[model samples]
Target chain A: MRGAVLHAPGDVRIEQLPDPAIVEPTDAIVRLSATCVCGSDLWPYRGINEVTEPTPIGHEYCGVVEEVGPGVSSVRPGQFVIGSFIASDNTCPHCRAGYQSACAHKVGMTGAQAELLRVPHADGTLVATPDDPDPELLPSLLTLSDVMGTGWFAAVAAGVRPGMTVAVVGDGAVGLLGVLSARRMGAERIIAMSRHEPRQKLATEFGATDVVPERGDDAVARIHDLTDGVGADAVLECVGTGEAMTQAIRSTRAGGGVGFVGVPHGVSIPGGRLFATMVRLHGGPAPVRRFLPDLIDATLRGEIDPGRVFDLDLPLDEVAEGYRAMDERRAIKAYLRP
Target chain B: MRGAVLHAPGDVRIEQLPDPAIVEPTDAIVRLSATCVCGSDLWPYRGINEVTEPTPIGHEYCGVVEEVGPGVSSVRPGQFVIGSFIASDNTCPHCRAGYQSACAHKVGMTGAQAELLRVPHADGTLVATPDDPDPELLPSLLTLSDVMGTGWFAAVAAGVRPGMTVAVVGDGAVGLLGVLSARRMGAERIIAMSRHEPRQKLATEFGATDVVPERGDDAVARIHDLTDGVGADAVLECVGTGEAMTQAIRSTRAGGGVGFVGVPHGVSIPGGRLFATMVRLHGGPAPVRRFLPDLIDATLRGEIDPGRVFDLDLPLDEVAEGYRAMDERRAIKAYLRP
Candidate 1:
C-alpha cells in the first residue's frame, strides 16, 4: 500500500508501505474512503517537532470495515464508520467520565493517508453511521475524526453559552470548525481572527458573525470592539504559539474562559496574569473519542459540513503535493482520496 | 485608633492612626475584635514583594459593626458580622455568576488590621449572624474571613467528588483549611502533604485520612502509591511556588483537576505537559465573597472549627512579634486582639 511517510522535516514522500492488519483481538482493518492533512501534521513538517523515523503521517479518516478480529463486536465488516483520532476502549473510568482521550487503554490512529489502516479498540472506538453515507459526505465525515471533534471540545471547554460572544484565534481547519461548533452551541456572535481569504470566507460561512484581520493586541482590540467594549465570553486558542495564547487571554472578558485545543509548542501560561484576570483555562487533548458519536451524528444530519474547509484534493500517489499545498498556504486543507 | 502598618521590610509597627469612617453611601465602619497575620503578609515582609510606603497590614478579621452608612440596610450598628477579604457589589454580572471576587465594583479590606475599618458595598459584603456568639468562637470565625474561604475555593475548583481521593499540596492556614473543606465536600480520602508536626496534627484532626511528609516528586509518588498508581482524583495547590504547582500536577490522575489558590510568583504552566497529562487547572484570587455567607452559616452552626490553625495569640501592640513568629516558622499563624 502507498502511504505518506515523514522521513524528516520538510521531507514527506509517497512510498510503498506494508498494509495494516488486525493484530489485536479488539482491532479491525479498514479500507479508507477519505482522509486529509491536519494542521498538527505541519508541526513536524516545519521542523519544529522532532521526526525520529519515517512516521506515518495522517490521523483523520472515514472508512469501511474490511475485517474485524475476534473480540470486535460493536462494529461489523463492511459497515461505514467514523472514528476519533484517539481510539479508546471506552470502558475505563476516564472514558466513562466523557474523557475517552485519556482512556486507560488508548491508542493513537495515524497513517490514515494510506489505502488500508488498522483501528484498535474497534468495539468501543468506532461509531457506525445509520446508513452508508454518500461519497459527497465522505470529506465531512472524515473531519469528525479529529478536526471537528477538537473544535467541539474547544467550545465545550471554553464554556460557550447562548447569547455569548466567542472569539476564535486561529484560521486553520480546526479553528474554522470551532466557529461552527460555537455557533451550533448557541453563541450569538462568533469572531474569527484570520488573515487568509479562504479560511475567512469559510469561517463566515460557518457562522462567524465577524472577522478580525489583525493579529495579537490589534486582534484582541477588534474583538472587544465587536463585543461592545466587553471582551468575548469565551476565547478559543486554536493556535499554539505564545502570542496566540496571549491574544486569546486578552480577547476574553475578565471572568471568561480560554479553551485551548492547540498542541502547544513552546508556549507557557503566565500564572500571575491568569490569576489577576480570574479567567478559567480548561484544555488539553480533545477527548475526541467522547465527541465522535455526536460529531458523526451532526455530520450525518447535515447540520455541519466541515469538509468545506478542504479546497484541494489529490490521489494517494500525490500525497506529497497535498502536504505541499497546505504547507505553502495555497490550500486551507487538502483531501486525499485513498 | 490603632493599626498595624508596614513601613518597610521587617518594619511592621502597631501605632495610632486616624479612625476609619464611612467614605461611600454603602460603607460601614467595623470595630475589629480580632485580626491575624497571613502567609501572604510575609511576602512583603520578607522583601520578596516591594513595599513603596507604610501600607496597612492584614486582611483577615472578625469584628462588630460600629456604624452603618446611609445605603447599608442589611448590616446594623452593633451587629456581629464575618466578612470576606474582598468587599464586592453583588449586583454585577460576574457576582451573579458566582465570582464575586471579580465583581465589577470590588474593594479591598486589607486595612482590617486597624481598630476600625470602613467596608464598602456593606449590604452585599457583610454577613451577620443571628446573634453575637460567645468569645470562644472568635478565632474560628476569623479564619472564615480569608483562609477558610480560600481553601474551600481550592477544593471546589479542583472538582472534588463525593467518593474520591484528594491531595492538598500545602500545609499553611489555607492548606489545612483545604483538608477541612475537602472533607466537608465529601472526599472519601484526603491526603495532606505536610512535614510540620503542628500542621500534620491539625490536618489529621481536620479529617485528612493520610499525611505524606514529602515534597515535589516524592510527594507525588507517595500520592500515586496511596491511590493505586492512578494518583488522586483532585489536587489542591495552596502553595504558590513553582515546585508546588508541579507537584500538584503530578499528584493528580489523568483527566483530573488542580485547584490552585496560592498567589503565584514566577510560576508557569507547561501547556504541552498539561495536555498530555490531561490535567485541568482552575484557580485565581478565590471568589471568597461568594462563599462567605455559606461558610459563615456553617461556622455559626458549629459545623467546623478553623481557628485551630493559630498557635499563638497576642494583643494588637505585639503585631511585630506576630509577623516575626510566622516568618521564623515559630508559629503556624498568630492572632492579634485589638
Candidate 2:
C-alpha cells in the first residue's frame, strides 16, 4: 500500500507502506474510497507542529469495509461507511453524552490518507450508510468524517436555534459549512466573516445572510452595526487566532454563546476579558461521530452539497501538490482519490 | 454620612461624606442596613488593584429605602430591598436575557458602607422584600446582593443538575455559598476545596459533602480520585488564580461544565489547553439581579443562611477595622452596620 508520510516540516512524500491489519477483535479494515488533506495537516507543513519522524498523515475517510474482526458484527464486509477522526467505543459515558472525542478508550485515527485504513471500535466508530452512496455523493460523505461534522458541532455548541442570528468568523471549508449548519438548524440570519472573494461567495451560497469582509476590531464593529449593536445571538469562532476568537466574543451579545472549533495556535485568552464578556464558551476537537449519522443522511438525501468544499482533487501519488494547493489557499479543500 | 474610603493601600479610613440624594430620575436613596467587605475588596487593599486616590468602597448592600426620585415608582421610602453590586436598568436586551450585570446602562454601585447610598436604575436594580426581615436574617440577605448571588451564578453556570457531582475550587465566602447553591440546585455531591478550618466548617454547614485541603495539582487529583477518575460533572472556580482555574478545568469530567466567577487579575488561559479539555466555560459579573427574587424569597422563608459566611461584624465607624480583619484573613467576611 502507498501512503503519505511527513519526514520533516514542509516535506510530505508518498511511499510504499505495509497495509493496516486488525489486531483487535473489535477492529475492521476498510479500503478507503475517498480521503482528503485537512487544514490541520497544514500545521506540520507550515512548521507549526513538530514532525520528529516519519509520521502517518490524515484522519478522515469514507470507505467500504473490506474485512472485519470476529467481534465486528454490526458492520459487514463490503458495506459503505464513514468514520470520525476520533474512534470511540461510543458506549462510554462521554460518548453517550455526545462527546466521543473525549470518550474513554478513544483512539485518534491516523494514516487514513492511504489505500487501506484500520479502524478500532468499528461498531461504535464507523456508521454504515443505508446503502452505498452515489459516486458524486462521496466527497460530501467524506466531509462528514471531520470538517462538516466539526462545523455542525460548532453551530450546535453555539446554541443556534430557529430565528436566531448567527455569525461565523472564518472562511475555510468548515466555516462555510458552519453557515450551512446554522441555516439548517433554522437560524434566520448568518454573518460570515471572510476577506477572500471565492470563500465569501461560497459562504453566501451556503446561507450567509450578510458578509463582513473586515477583520478584528473592525469586523466586530461591523457585526455590531449589522445587528444594531446587540451583536449576533450566536457567534462561531471558526478560526483559532487570538483576533478571531476576540472578534467572535465581541460580536456576540452579552448573553450569547461562542462556539470555537478552530484548532488554536498562539491564542492566549485573557481570563479577565472572558469573564467580563459574559458569553458562554464551548468548543474542542468536535466529536464528529456524534453528528456523522445526521450529516451522512443529509448528504444521501442531497439536502446539502458539502462536497463543494473540495475544489481540487488528485491521485494519492500527487499528495504533495494537494498539500501545496491547500497551503497556498488555491483550493478550499483538496480531495485525494486513493 | 460616614463611609469607608481607601486613602492608600492598607490605609482604609472612616471619613465624613455628604449624604447622597436621588440624582437620576430612576435613582433611589437607601439607608444601608448591612454592608460587607468582599474578597475582591482585598485586591485593592493589598495593592493588587491600584488605589489611586481616596476612593469610596463597598458595593454589597441590603437596606431600607430612604427616598425615591419622581420616576422611581416600583420602590419607595420604608421599603426594604436587596440590590446587586452592579445596578442595571433591566430594560435592555442583555438585561431582559437575564444578564442584568452586563446591561447596556449598567452602573457599579459603591459606598454602600456609608449610612446612606444612592442606587441608580432603582426600579430595575432593587428587588424589594415581601416584608421587613428579622435582624437575625440581615447578614444572609446582605450576601444576596453580591457573594451569595455570585455563588449561585457559578453553580448555575457550571450546569449543576440533580444527581451530579460538583467541585468548588475556592474557600472564600462565595465558594462556601456556591456549595449551598449547588446543594439547593440538587447536586448529589459537593466537594469544597479548602485548607482553612473555619471556611471548611462553613462549607460543611452550607452542604459541602467533602473538603479537599490540597491545592493545585493535588486538589485536581483528589477530585478525580473522588469521582473514580471521571472527574466531577461540574466545577466552580471561585478563586481568580491560574492554578485554581487550571485545577477547576482539570477536575471536571470531559464534556463537563466550569463556572468561573472570581475577578481574574493576571490570569491568561492557554487556548490549546482549554480546547483539549472539551469543557464548557461560562462566568462573569453574574446577573445577580436575575436570582434576587428567588434568593429573597428563600431568605424570607428561612430556606438558606448564606449570612453565616460573615464571621465578624463592625460598626460603620470601624470600617478600617472591617477591612483589616478581612485583609488579614481573620474574618471570612466583615459586616458593617451602617
Candidate 3:
C-alpha cells in the first residue's frame, strides 16, 4: 500500500506503507475509491501547523468496504459507504443529539489518503448509499464525508431558513458548498465574500446572489449595504480566522446567527462584541456523520454537484503535486483517485 | 423632581433635578410607581464600572403614563404600563425579529429613580397592562422592565424545551428569575449554582430542583454529575464575569445552548474552546420589549412572582441606602418607591 505522508512543512511524499488491517472488533477495512486534499491539510503543509513527525494525511474519503470485523453489523464488504472525518459510536448522547463530532467514543480518522484505510466504529460512523452509486456521482458522494457536510452544518447552525438572506465568509470548498446548502435550505439571497475571480464564479454557480470581494470590516460594510443596513439574516463562517469570524458576526442582523465551521487558529471573541451584536454563535468541527446519509441520497439524486469544487484531479501517486497546487492557490481543491 | 445621581464611585445621592419634559413626539412622561436597584448597579457603586460625572442613575421602572407627546398613540395618560429598560421603536427589522434591544432607534433608559421619566418610542416601547394592578403586583411588574424580562430572554435564548435539564449560573435577581423562567418553559430539572444561603433558598422557591454551591471547574463538574455526565441541555449565564461565561459553556452539552444576559465586564471566549466544546452561545442585553406584553399578562394573572427577589424596600429619597445594601450584598435587590 502507498500513502501520502508529511515529513515536514511543505514536504509531502508518497511512500510505500504497510496496509491497514481491522484492529478493533468494530473496525472495517475500506479500499478507498477516492480521496482529496482539504484546506485544513494546507495548515500543516504550509507549516502554519507544526509537523513534528512524519504523519499519515487526508481524512476525507469514500470507497467500498473491502472487509469488516465480525462486530460490524451496519456495513458489509462490497457496499459503497461514506463516513465522517471523525468516527463516532453514534449512540452517545451527543451523537444522538446530532453532534457526532463530540461523540463520547469518537476517533478522528486519518491515513485515508492510502489505498486501504481502517475505520473504527464502523456500525456507527459509516453510512451506506441506497445502492452502488453511479461512477459520475463519486466526486459528490466523496464530499459528504467532510466538506459538503460541514457546509450543510454551517447553514443549519446559522438557522438559514426560507426567504433568508445568507452571507458566506469564505470562498473555500466548504464555503462554496455553504452557498449550495443555503440555497437548498431556501435562503432567498446569498452573498459570497471572495477576492478570487474563479472562486467567486464558482460561488455564483452554487447559488450566490451577490459577491463582495472585500475582507474584514469592509466585508461587513458591504453586506450591510447589500441588505439595506439590516445585515444578513444568517452568515456562514467557513474560514476560522479571527477576521472571518468578526465579519460573519457583524454581517448578521441582530437575532440572526453565525454558523462557523473553520478550525480556529488565533480567534478570541470579546464578550462585549458578542453582547452588542446580539447574534447567535454556533459551530465547530462539523458533525459530518450526522448528515452523511441524507447528503449521499441528495448527491445520488443529482440535486447538487458539490464535486465541482475539485478543480484539480490527480492520481494518488502524484499526491505531492496535489498538495502543491492547493498550497499555491492554483486549485480550489485537489481530488485524488486512489 | 428628585432623582438618584452618582457623583462618583460609592457615592449615590438623591438630588433635586429638573423635571423631564417630552423632547420628542414619541416621548411619554411617566410618573414612576416604583424603581429598583439592579445587580448591575453594584458595578458602578463598587467602582467596577467607572462612574465619572454626577449622572442620573436607575433604568428599571414601572409607572402610570402622566403625559404623552402628540405623536404617542399606543399609550395615553392614565394608563399603567411597563417598558423595557432600553426603549426601542419596535417596527425596525431587528425588533420585528424579536430583538428590540437592537432596534434601529433604540435608547437606553436612565433617571427612572426620579418622580418622572421621559420614555422615548412610547408607542413601541411601552406595553400597557390590562388595567391598574393591585399594590401587591407592583414589584413584579417593575421587574419586567429589566430583571424578569432579562431572565425570560435567557431561558428563551438558551432554547429551553420540555423535559430538558437546565442550569443557571449566578444567584442574582436575574438568575433567580431565570430559574422561574426555565420552569415556565417546561424544564424537567433546574440546577441553580449559588454560594449564598438566602439566594439558594430563593432559587429553590423559584423551582430549582438542584443547587450546586461550587464555582468554576467544580461547578462544571457538579453539573455534569447531576446530569449523569451529560451536561445541562440549556444554561442561563446571568453573571457576566469571564469565569461565569466559561463555567456556563463548559457545563452545557454539545449542541446545547448558553444564553448569557450578564453585562460582560471582561470576558473573552477562546475560539478553540468554543469550537471543541460545540456548545451554542447566544445572548446580550435582553430584548425586553419583545417579551413585555406576554410577561405583563402573566404578571397580571399572578402566574409568576419574580418580585420576591426585592428583599429590601426604600423610599425615593433613600435611594442611597438601596445602593449601599446591594453593594454590600445585604440584599438580592432593592425596590424603591418614587
Candidate 4:
C-alpha cells in the first residue's frame, strides 16, 4: 500500500508501506475511499513539530470496511463508514459521557492517510453510514472525522446559543466549519476573523454574518464594536497561540464562554485576568464521535456541505503536492484519493 | 466613623475617618455589624500584591442599613443585610444572567471592615435576612456575604454531581467552605488538600471525606491513587498560585471540570496538556448574588456552620491584630466586630 510518511520535517513523501491488519479482536481493516491533509499536519511539515521517524500521517477518512476481527460487531466487511481521529471503546465511562477523545481505551488513527487503515475498537469507533455516500458527499463526510467534529465541539463547548454573537478566530477549514457549526447551533451573528479571500468567502457562505480581517487586539475591538462593546457571547479559538487565546478571552463578554479547540503548546492564561474577566473557558478535543451521526446525516441530507473547504484534490501518489498547496496557503484543504 | 486602613503591608489600624454618605442615587450607608479578614486581604499583607496608598481593606460583611439613597427600593434604612464583595446593580444582561460579579454597574465593596460602609447599587446589591436573627448566627450570616457564597460558586462551577469524587485544593476558609458546598451539592467524596490540622478538622467536619497533605505533583498523584488512578471528577482551585492551578488541573479526571474561585495572577495553563486531557476550566469572581439566597437559607436552617472556620474574634479596634492573625496563618479566618 502507498501512504504519506514524514521522514523528517519538510520531508513528506509517498512511499510503499505494509498494509494494516486487525491485530486486536476489536479491530477492523478499512480501505480508505478518501483522506485529506489536516492543518495540524502542517505543524510538522512546516518544521514546527519535530519528526524523528518515518511516521505515518493523516487521521481523517471516509472508507469502506475491508475486513473485521472476530470481536468486531457494529462494522462489517464492505460497510461504508466514517471514523474519528481518536478511536475509543465507546462503552467506557468517559466515552459514555461524550468525551470520546479521552476514552479509557483510545487509539490514534494516524495511518488513515494510507490505502488500507486499521481501526481499533471498531464496534464503538466507526459509525456505519446508510450506504456508500454519494461520490460528491465524500468530502463533507470525510471532514466529520476531525475538522467538522472539532468545530461542532467548539460551538457546543462555548455554549453557543440562538440570538448570540459568536466570533471565530481562525480562517482554516476548521474555523470555516466552526462558522457552520455556530450557525447550525442557532447563532444569530458570526464574525469570522480571516485574511485570506477563499476562506473568507467560505466563512461567509457558511453563515458568518460578518468577517473582520483583523487579528489580536484589533480583532477583539472589532468584535466588541459589533456587539455594542459587550464583546461576543461566545468566541471560538480555533488557532492555538498565546495571542489567539488572549484575543479569544478578551473578545468574549464578561461572563461569556470561550471554546478553545487549538492544540496549544506553551500557552498559559494569567489567573488574575481569567478570574477578573469572569469568562468561562471550556474546550479540548472535540468528541467527534458524539456528533458524527448527525453530521453525517446532515451531509447526506445536503443541509451542510463542509467539504467546500477542500479546494484541491490529487491522486494519493501526489500527496506531497497536496501538502505543499495547503502549506503555501494556496488551498483551504487538500483532498487525496487512494 | 471608624474604618480599618492599611497604613503599610503589615500595619493596619482602626482610625476615625469621615462618615460615609450616599453620594450616588444608588448608594446606601450601612452600619457594619460584622466583617472579617479574607484570604485575598493577605495578598497585600504578605506583600505578594503591591500596596501603595493607605488602602482601606476588607470586602466581606453583614451590616444594618443606616441610610438609603432615593433610588434604593428593595432595601431601606434599618434593614439587616448581607452584601457581597462586589456590589452589582443586577439590571444589566450580565447581572440578570446570574453573574452579578460582572454587573454593568459593578462596584467593589472593599473597606467593609469599618464601623460604617457605603454600599452601592443598594436596590440589587443587598439581601435582607428575615427580621433580626439570633446574635449567635452573626458569624455564619457574615460568611454568606463572601466566603460561603464564593465557595458555593466553586462547587457550581466545577459541576459537582452526586456520588462524584470532588477535590478542594486549598485549606483556607473558602476551600473549607467549598467542602461544605460540595456536600450540599451531593458530592459523595470530598478530598481536601491540607496539612493544617485545624483546617483539616474543619474540612472533615464540613464533610471532606479525605485529606491529602501533599502539595503539587505529589498531591496530584495522591489524589489519583485515592481515586483508583482516575483522579477526582471535579476540582476546586481556591489558591491562585501556578502550582495550585497545575495541581487542580492534574488532580482532575480526564473530561472532569475545574472551578477556580481564587484570584489568579501569574497562573497559566499549557494549552496542549489541557486540550489532550479534555478538562473544562470555568471560574472567576464568585457570582455571590446568585447563591446568596440559598446559602443564607442553608445557614439559617443550621444545615451548615461556615463561620466555624473563623478561629479568632476581636473588636473593630483590634483590626490590626485580626489582619496579622490571618496574614500569618495563625488563624484560619478572623471575625471583626465593627
Candidate 5:
C-alpha cells in the first residue's frame, strides 16, 4: 500500500508501506475512496509540533470497507462508510451523551492518507451510507470524517438557533463549513470574519449574511458594530489562538454562546473575563461520529455541498503537493484520490 | 440613618450616615426589612480583597418602599419588594435575554446594610410581592435579593435537569441554596461537597442526597466514585477560587455543564484542559433580577426556606459582630435587623 509520511518540517513523501490488517477484533480495513489534508496536519509539518520521528500522516477519510473482523457486525466489506477521525466505542457514557470524542474507549486515527487504512471499533465508529454514494458525493462524505462535522458541532455548541445572529471566526475549511452549518440551523444573520478575498467570497456563498475582514480586537469591534452593540447571539471560534478565543468571547452578547472547535496552541482564559462577559463556552475535538449519519444523508440528498471546500484535487502519488499547497495557503483544502 | 462601614481589615463599625435619598429619577428609597452578612463580605473583611477606604458595606436586602422618585412606577411607597444586589434596567437587550447582571444600565448596590437604602432603576430593578408577606416569609424573600437567586442561577447555568446527578461545591450559603435549587429543578441525586457538620446537616435538609466531605482532587474523585466513574451530570461551582473551579470542572462528566457563580479572584482556565475535558462552562454574577419574581412568589407560597442559611440574627447596632461571625466562620450567615 502507498501512503503519505511526514519526515520533517515541510517534507512529505509518498512511499510504499505495508498494508494494514485488522489488528483488533473490532477493526476493519478501509480502501480509501478519498482522503484530505487537514489544517491540523500543518502543526507537525511546520515543526510547531515536534516531529520526534517519521510518521504516517492524515486522519480524514471515507471509503469502501475492504474487510472486517468477525467482531465487526455493523459494517460489512464492499460497503461505503464514513467515520470520525477519532474512533469511539459508542457505548460509553460519554458516547451515549453525544460526546464520542471523549469516549471511554477511544482511539485517535493516523496513517489514514493511504490506499488501505485500518479502523478500530469499526462497529461503533463507522456509519455506512444508504448505498455506495456517487463519485460526486465522495468529497462531501469524506468531510464527515472531520471538517464538516466539526463545523456542525461548533454551531450546535454555540447554541445557534432560528433568528439568531451568529459570528464565525477563522476562514479555514471548518469556518466556512460553520457558516454553512449556521445557515442550515436557521440562523437569521451569519457573519464570517476573514481577511482573504477568496475565502470571504466562499463564506458568502456558504450563506454568510455579513463578512468582516478584520482580526483580533478589530474583529470584535466590527461584530459589535454590526450587531447594534449587542454583539452576536453566538460566535464560533475556529482558530485555537488566545486572540481568536478572546475575540470570539467578546463578539458574543451576554448570555450568548461561544463554540470553540480549534485545537488550542496557547490559549488561557482569564476567569474574571469569562465571568464578566457571561457567555457560555463549549467546545473541543468534535464528536464527528455523532453527525455522520445525518450529514451523509444530507450530502446524498444534495442538501449541502461541503465538498466545494476542496479547491485542489490530486492523485494519490501527488500527496506531497497536497500538503505543500495547503501549507502555502494556496488551497483551502486538498482532496486526494487513492 | 445608620450603616455598616469597613474602615479597615477586621474593622467594621456601625456609624451614623446621611439617610439615602433619591439621587436618580429612577431611584427608590426602601426601609430595609432585613439585611445579611454574605460570604463575599469576608473577602474585604479578612483583607483578602484590599479595603482601600471606609466603604459602605452590604448589597443584599429586602425592604418596604418608603419613597419613590417621580420616574419610578413599579413599586410605590409601602409596597414590599426584593431587588438584586446589582440593579439593572430590565428592558436592555442583555436583561431581556435574562442576563440582567450584564444589562446595558447596571448599578452595583451598596450601603444596603442601612436603615434606608436607595436602589437605582427602581421600575426595572425591584419586584413587588403580591402583598406584604407574613413575618415568617421575610428571610426567604430577602434571599431572593442575592444568595437564593445566585444559587438558582448556578443550578440553571449548570443545566440541571430531571434525574441528573448534580454536585455542589462550597458549603457556603450560596452552595447550600444551590442544593435546594437543584432539588427544585428535579435533579434526582444531589451531592453536597462540605466538610462542616452543620453545613452537611443543612445540606441534607435542603435535599442533598449525598454528602462528600472532601476538597479539590479528593472531592472530584469522590464525585466520580459516586457516579460510578462517570462523574456528575452537572456541577455548581459556588466557590470563587481556582481550586474550586478546577474541581468543579473535573467532577463533571464529558458533555456535562459547570455553572459557576463565584466572583473569581485569581482564576485562569487552561485551554488544553478545558478542550480535553469537553465540559460546558457558563457563569457570572447571578442575574438575580431575572429570578426574583418567581423566587419571591415561591417564598410567599411557603415552598422554599432559603433564609434558613442565616444562623445568627443580630440587631443593626451589632453589625460589627455580624461581620465578625461570618468572617470567623462562626456563623453560616448573619441576619441584621434595623
Candidate 6:
C-alpha cells in the first residue's frame, strides 16, 4: 500500500509501505475511503516541531471496516465509520465524562494517510454510520475523525451559547469549522479573524457574522470594536501561536471563555494578565470520540457542509502536492482519495 | 483615623491618617467591624511584589455602613454589609455577568485596615446583611468579604461536582476556605496540601478528608497515589507561586479542572505542559459581589465558619503586629479590630 511519509522537513513522499493489519483482538483493519492533510502536520513539515525520523503522516480518516478482529463487535466488515484521532476505550471514567481523548486506555491512531490502517479500540473508538455515506459527504465525514470534532470541542470549550457572540481566531480548517460549530451551537454572532480573502469568504459561508482581517493587537482591537469594547462572549483560539493565544484571551469579555484547540508551540499564558482579564480558559486535545455521533448525524442530515474546507482533492499518489498546497495556503485543506 | 502604611519592605506602621470622605456620589463610609491581613498582603511585605509608594494596605473587610452619599441606595448608613476587595459598579456588563472583579468601572477597596474606609460604587459592591450578626459569627462573616468568596470561586471554577475528589494547593486563609467551599459544593473528598500542623488541623476541620503535607513533585506523586494514579477530579490553586500552580495542574486528572484564585506575582503558565495535561483552567479574582448575597445568607444561617482562618487578633493600633504574624506564618491570618 502507498502511504505518505515525511523523510525530512518539507519532504513528503508517497512511497510503498506495508498494509496495516489488526494486531490486537479489539482492532480493526480499515480501507480508507477518504483521508486528509492536517494543519498540525505542517508543524513538523515547516521545521517548527522537531521531526526526529521519517514519520508516517495523517491521523484523520473516513473509512470502511474491511475486517474486524475477534473482539470487535460495535463495527464490522464493510461498515462506514469515523473515529477519533485519539483512539479510546470509551468505558473509562474520563471517556464517560465526555473526555475520550484522555481515556484511561487511550492510543493515538496515526498513519491514516494510507490505503489501509489498523485501528485499536475499534468498539469504543469507531462509530458506524447507519449506511455507507454518499460520496458527496466523504469530505465531511472524513472531518468527523478529527478536524470537525476538534472544532466542535473548541466551541463547547468556549461555552458558545445561544444568543452569545463568539469570535474565532485563526483561519485554518479547524477555525472555519469552529465558525460552523458555533453557529450550530446557536451562537447569535461569530466574528472570524482571517487575513486571507479566501478563508474569510469560507468563514462567512460557515456563518461568521463578521470577519476581522487583522492580527495581534489589531485583531484584538477589531474584536473589541465589533463588540462595543466588551469583546466576544466566547473566543475560540484555533491558532497555537503566542500572538493568537494572547489575542484570543484579549478578545473575550471579562467572564467569557476561550476554547483553545490549536496545538500550542511557544505559547505562554501570562498569569497576571489572565487573572486581571478574568477570562475562563478550557481546552486541550479534542475528545473527538464524544462528539463523533452528533457531528456525524449533523453531516448525514446535511445540516453542515464542513467538507467545503477541502478545496483541493488529489489521488493518494499526489499526497506531497496536497501537503505543499496546504503549506502555501493555496488550499484551505487538501483531501486525498485512498 | 489610623491605617497601616507600608513605608518600605518589612515596615508596616499604624499611622494616624486623615479620615476618608466620599470622593464620589456612589461612595460610602464604613466603620470596619473587622478587617484582616491576607496572604496576598505578605507579597508586598516580603518585598516579593513591588511596593513603589507608601501604600495604605488591606483590601478585605466586613463592616457597618456609617454614611452613604446621596447616590447610594442599595446600602445605607447603620446597615451591616460585606463587600468584595474589588469594588464594582454592578450595572456594568461584566458585573451583570457575575464577574464584578472585572467590572469596567472597578476599584480595589484598599485602606480597610484603617479605622474607617471609603467604599466606591457602594450600591453595586456592598451586600447588606439582614441584621447585625452576633460577635461569634464575626470571623466567618469577615471572610465572606474576600477569602471565602475567593475560595468559593476556586471550587466553582474548578468545576467541583458531587462525588469528585478535590485537591487544594496552598494552606493560607483562602486555601482553608477552599476546602470548606468544595465540601459545600458537594465534592465528596477534599485534599488540602499543607505542611503546617495548625493549617492541616484547620483543613481537616474545614472538611479536608486528607492532608498531603507534600510540596511540588512530592505533592503531585502523593495525589496520584491517593487517586489510583488518576489524580484529583478538581484542583483549587490558592497559592500564587509558579510551583503551586504547576503542582495544581499536575495533581489534577487528565481532562479535570483547575480553579486558580491566587493573586499571581511572577507566575507564567507553560502552555505546552498544560496543553499536554488537558486540564480545564479557569480563575481570577473572585467575583465576590456576585456571590455575596448567597454567601451572606449562608453565613447568617450559621452554615459555615470560614472565620476560623483568622488565628490571631489584635487591636487596630496593632495592625503592624497583625502583618508581622501573618508574614512570619505565626498566624494563618490576622484580624484587626478597630
Model 4, range B25-122, lDDT digits (tens) per residue?
A: 98999999999999999888888889898988899988899999898889888889999899999888788889999998899888888998999998
lDDT of each: 0.88, 0.92, 0.94, 0.89, 0.94, 0.91
Which digits, one per residue and each the tens of the lDDT, describe model 6 over residues B1-338? 99989878899999999999998999999999989898888888999888899989999988899999999988889999888999999997888888999899999878889889999999998988888889888888889899999999999999999999999999999999999999999989999999999999999998999999988899899999999888899999999878989999999987789999998878899888877888888899999888888988898888888888888989988888888888888989998898
The alpha-carbon lDDT assigned to residue A89 of candidate 4 equals: 94
Worst ten in a row by lDDT for model 3 chain B: B38-47
Residues B74-164 of candidate 2: C-alpha lDDT, one tens digit per residue: 9999999999999999999889989999999999988887888999999999999878889999999999999999999999999999999
Per-residue lDDT over B1-338 for candidate 5, one digit per residue giving the tens place of the 0 to 100 score = 99999999999998999998899999999999999888888899899999998999999998899999999987899999889999999999999999999999999988888898999999999999888889988888888999999999999999999999999999999999999999999999999999999999999999999999988888888999999899999999999999999999999998899999989989999998899999999999999999987888788888899999989999989989988888778899999997
What are the per-residue Cα lDDT tens digits for candidate 1 across A1-338? Answer: 98889999888888889988779999999889998899899989989999998898898988999999999999999899888888899998778878888888888888988888899999888989988998898988988888888988889888899999899999998899999999999999999999888788889999999999999778878887787555789999898888988999888876688889999989888888877777767777798878877777877888889889889989888888888888898988899998
Residue-by-residue lDDT tens digits, candidate 3, A1-338? 99999999989988999999889999999999999999999999988899999999999999999999999999999999899999999999999999999999999998888898999999999998878888988889899999999999999999999999999999999999999999999999999999999999999999999999988788888899999999999999998999899889999999999999999999999999999999999999999988987887788888999999999999999999999998889999999999
Q: Which stretches of candidate 2 lie over 4 Å from their true place?
A: none
lDDT of 5 at B14: 89
TM-score of chain A of each: 0.98, 0.99, 0.99, 0.99, 0.99, 0.99
- Enumerate the candidates' DockQ scores in order: 0.63, 0.82, 0.93, 0.71, 0.90, 0.79
Task: Give the per-residue lDDT of model 6 (tens digit) for A13-40.
Answer: 9889988877999999999999999999
DockQ-based ranking, best first? 3, 5, 2, 6, 4, 1
lDDT by residue for model 3 over B1-338, one digit each (tens)? Answer: 99999888989999999999999999999999999998888888889998878889899998999999999999999999899999999999889999999999999998888899999999999998878999999999999999999999999999999999999999999999999999999999999999999999999999999999999889999999998898999999999999999999999999999999999999999999999998999999999998888888888889999999999999999988888888888988999998
Which model, 2 or 5, shows the larger DockQ? 5
Query: Which has the higher TM-score value, candidate number 1 or candidate number 6?
Result: 6
lDDT of 6: 0.91
Error of 4 at B14 (Å): 1.7
The CAPRI class of candidate 2 is: high
Candidate 4 chain A: 10-residue stretch with minimal lDDT: A263-272
Candidate 2 vs candidate 6, lDDT winner = 2
Model 2 per-residue lDDT tens digits across residues A1-338: 99999888878999999999989999999999999999999999888988888998999898999999999988999999999999999998889888999988999988989999999999999999998888999999999999999999999889899999999999998899999999999999999999899999999999999999999889989998998778899999888888889889888987788999999998888899889988888899999999988888889989999989999989999999999998999999999999
Clashing pairs in 6: B139-B307, B140-B307
Superposition error at B216 for model 3 (Å): 1.0
